[model samples]
Target: MSSPLKSLHFAVFPLPAQGHMVPMMDIARILAHRGATVTILTTPVNAKRFNSVIERAVEAKLKLQVVELQLRLAEVGLPEGCESLDMLSSTDPWFKLLGAFDMLEEPAEQVLRRLSPVPDCIISDNFIPWTSDVARRLSIPRLIFHGPGCFSILCMHIVTSTSVLDGIESDSELFVLPGLPDPIEVTKLQAFGQSKPNATKPQVSDNSEAKTKEKKGYIERVQEGEKAAHGILVNSFEELEPEYAHELAKAKDKKIWCIGPVSLFNKSDLDIAERGNKAAINEHDCLKWLEGREPGSVVYVCLGTLTHTSLEQIIELGLGLEMTDLPFIWCIRNKTEELERWFSESGFEERVGDRGLIIYGWVPQVLILSHRAIGGFLTHCGWNSTLEAVCAGVPMVTWPHFADQFFNEKFIIQVLKVGVRIGVEIPVVMGGEDTAETLVKKEEVKVAVECLMNGGDEGEERKKRAQELAEMAKTAMKDGGSSIRNTTSMIQDITEQLAINV
Candidate 1:
């Protein structure tokens, strides 16, 4: 059959966050490779970051382009160079950044208008719901790209749509989420953005109330935009969560495309190494460090980019890593001067000696996870990390921090049986002061790591299941695989819908 994607043009816009942007870029590459012309729309700083990916795609002769939209941070009352969320110092600027993103709609629409071949589809990050408006004006279909997997989205839908939380009084009380293939256990605390009921609440500052209103307005728009969109494009595969994927489609009443483990699209070593930000450690150095270790002997720890660890939490985590006495590679972020002082005074570097390698910033996560020496992962259960660990056949020690991570942890530990939780219950908002007290202590961390890394019947069984999932992930990306078939079907359906609208 003729490729439905042939000569089609797609406009891709991703939110300027690590987790959201990376997968959307992968999706763009996937579409270009599938014979669709793709244009990635973003601000100047983000456009610069896409240079490497764009260059590689161009070299391979894929029809991909990037259009830069300069963000007016001053107009939005945000600092200059605050193009991405990571650049912010506090949560205060978050809403302002969202406001700045709103200013881009006109420029983006104009850019779309001037393209030689108008885009047939607009695939934008879920946060940028105004793209639905752009699609409406241009008379093209819009598809929302949800960063999390089908299961998490389903859980979120249930929390919002069903009476699941009607009588839940305590944060730690467990409840079974209704309408799923498996009875997934979830605490009220695990619900994303679930507000706490304080008996004696502090008076809300006028400024805080304004910010809350702005946030609420933005969230409502996003929900409405998602409903108005033609469908959803998720970074998941059918075999990975067939029932949940189908259920999510039914719940949303939209055609959901599970075309993922999208990281697999990076076939070359250079692509893998340079997938996200430039690696703090060289690919050769990282591989050399793992070369002498025995297979399945090392534990790789990284809590993702967005999460911040307090000095107290860092000390506890460091202590836990020391207690395990296993070969490890930990990628840490937000290295404060106090943390450095503690590292120096605590003799952490001298004690661990050559047994542990600490990367202070970005490391090539995908490459490290795929290494043979990687036995277990200490992760925050972000969708990317969870899916990457599954793809690499590495069992996880899940320590979910917030957002969809809690749901992801359950899916990893309960559904897949290839992970162990570190016993964190309460969902934390970013930049909250109470994080130090709520974090998993050293004992919990040590025990979970030991359980995952040490070889036992249970550990071996987990390894077996992980390897099975890895094989499934590989098959799903191959020719005639579930993910590939989904992609083809999505393109064909979009084409039919566009024709009907015409």
Candidate 2:
């Protein structure tokens, strides 16, 4: 009943964001299932949120535990008890979050030094670059946890590091991304939204009071941890982006391991059942509505946690979704006060009645995407959501809002050949941080939706390829798949290092 790999112990520190936490927790689950002693270093408030899940896992006898390391939000000017970035009411907290993240190093190192049975290695989100220093001082190997696939990471690397877009001044100028397996075209607008390797100093901002000069140093050092990490751990299979994975390793000069769709390895059906029982969710209504629909007929919509659009844009989007005349479930993410105004005035709810469902709060995304009724996804192209859609075999209708998302959109359309874009007229600048997205007219939305669901040649081709990808994703987690072998290699690498450290 005991694990032979009990001698291998690991400490995991995930960035306190929903997207980051979910995948990292899955990594912990995989490690613990393999008999490794796992300590998840997190803030007390954030730790408590995930504790119930870990408790259940432990009750099921997985070797995992959550250790709350002190993280004083007040020290960094955030309100008391503001545990996660998503809890904040603001639009741009990138620098503010980094400042708070930097403050955790002292507490984390103290926790690491005193861990009774010292861990063999530390696996951390690359956002928390400071952890690499702690691991080095403590004589342990540290591995970087990347939430996005190799394709997105490598695309960003090339776009930022090289002059891939240096000469272009026009938004329409398209260039092929260097070093990719497929030829992908990007306009000046789309490429400029990415965080360049050497960013020019900002002139000034309306909210400059919230930032300090010290935080600028942290921003510059975002990629510094890669140089110090033992290797990089990515949440993608080689079959999904084999060439990009290889290019990423060569670009960063770090050994790479592809050991995910980690969520596929989740050990808790109880967790899902508990979530399903929540009465306020109205999940049953969605399910009931889906029951009558033909297979792969409905569209699933979610724009992710951080994206905020103008009220005008929301109305436009709602009108656009309505124009499709097909069934849809849109997970709207605006303030509760403003939701009714958008829906009621447009007669949006009344117009579509049982056909269009608007979900305001948390909904089981992974479950919804995999449902038989979900033929297409209208997504913000966040990595976690992108991979989930790919695994679910649902085609994407990508409307990328920020960061790695635009690049991820390319991965789906250009590389995977499983989705279409909303033809966002102009690229929303810098992850939609400084500037607001220009309205994607109702017509653009209607056209993209029509293409994805029309069952025509292009639509059928995309659906076929998406289903094939779904098969590959499932196979990757199977015993003989590349991911399973890669996972073994990661365990052996750490286990070997643990022996040397011993």
Candidate 3:
């Protein structure tokens, strides 16, 4: 008799965020490298991005495939190519469910049924809770990629399904989590408007009560779907957060695997190294702008795609960079009007002409961070950004925005001590507040940047720690390292299962 096939086929559903897509693609590539047939499912917009990466992957001979799904919203008459989250934001929760229920779940199920050879398993984003149900219906074992640290996932599980936040009085700091060794200040929780301790969900006026009620119901449905997922896949190293991972394993009945620092898994592969080269952004016609600069001279400032800073904040940041007098590259996304005019009128560009370069739109974040000239990062503390910075051995100036950014900021500053929090008082805005309570002034930003760039006693200490963590991250991704071992084990398990099924 012919030997049974050992190769597995995996279908991955990645959320649209850059952070989510990149790591999921990495995992898919790794599986394909190990002789599995991998197909990634993403929206058209994201699929295009994945295609760019896949083109590079193919040129490098990494065997993987991508499938693009058309998200249907014709009943509401929305245009094609709209983001999944953006389309759902303004609509009632029930209306949003139509996309997950009718659009995503239905379409995904159809694709699976029609596959030439059905997939052996489905890997999905935890954000798309409906995926679990679809996988179950297809009799495919499902894995939910958490896309963040175990602590961050555990925190979200507590905040979303439970009344943990309700227990904390407004403006009062309560130690809110159970899994971690130290108490997590209630202010550090990542939920709707919780980054700023007092920041609360936006309250609807009398005229919008009906819309508000619909939103509440929508949230309930989403939560219900989240509770049904089979297993959780965390993109973190057990060595980095053993305590939190253990706690999560106990609290959640699902299998948890710490397979990460995924970016570093294939440094020795020439093809993969060349693929990394494509992520570089070209601006100002100077690719090596910071070449030969002092080891700790440049400060790389990048706020992720989703964040938008006000003109006031922009001006303050520019002035702060000037005050620091360090070579810097700032990646700014112009999502609002008047930002360009304000920069020109303020003469901020002239003030730091050669000292800084501010590029608009997306940046080659990974390449820039990995550069030797980039000694530190002024970041929004997004999980991907944080992990990249750690891998690159770059320290950070933490300025958290929304969602799990606050939790990431805490881990970097408090737990890892590889970075410094820019402002002393964590800003808190009570729910429905009209104005922000704590604003990061220009001087504070300057001091933080300077401290990280110029090595003072404390800066030196942080610098040493940052370098050590960077080495650890690098070691973990090497052959026989923790991340590679876990990935190999995962692939072996899937292959064995596929053999039995076949």
lDDT string for model 2 (320-420, tens) is 88888999988776555676766767677898888887777667777678779899999989898999898889999998865677788989988899999
State the displacement of the C-alpha of residue 378, model 1, in Å, after optimal TM-score superposition.
0.5
Candidate 1 segments exceeding 4 Å error: 1-5, 91-93, 193-207
RMSD of 1: 2.6
Ranking by TM-score: 1, 2, 3
Instruction: Estimate TM-scores for all models.
Output: 0.96, 0.91, 0.86
For model 1, the run of ten residues with the poorest summed lDDT: 197-206
| lDDT of all predictions | 0.86, 0.76, 0.68
Please estimate how well model 1 matches the true structure, expressed as its whole-model Cα lDDT. Answer: 0.86
For model 2, the superposed segments whose C-alpha errors exceed 4 Å read 1-6, 170-172, 192-216, 267-285, 425-437
lDDT of 3 by residue, 91-129 (tens): 222243234424577777888888867888888876666
lDDT of 1 at 313: 86
- Give the range of the ten consecutive residues with the poorest summed lDDT in model 2: 197-206
Q: Tens digit of lDDT per residue, candidate 1, span 285-336?
A: 9999999899999999998876767788888898899999999999997778
Better model by TM-score: candidate 1 vs candidate 2: 1
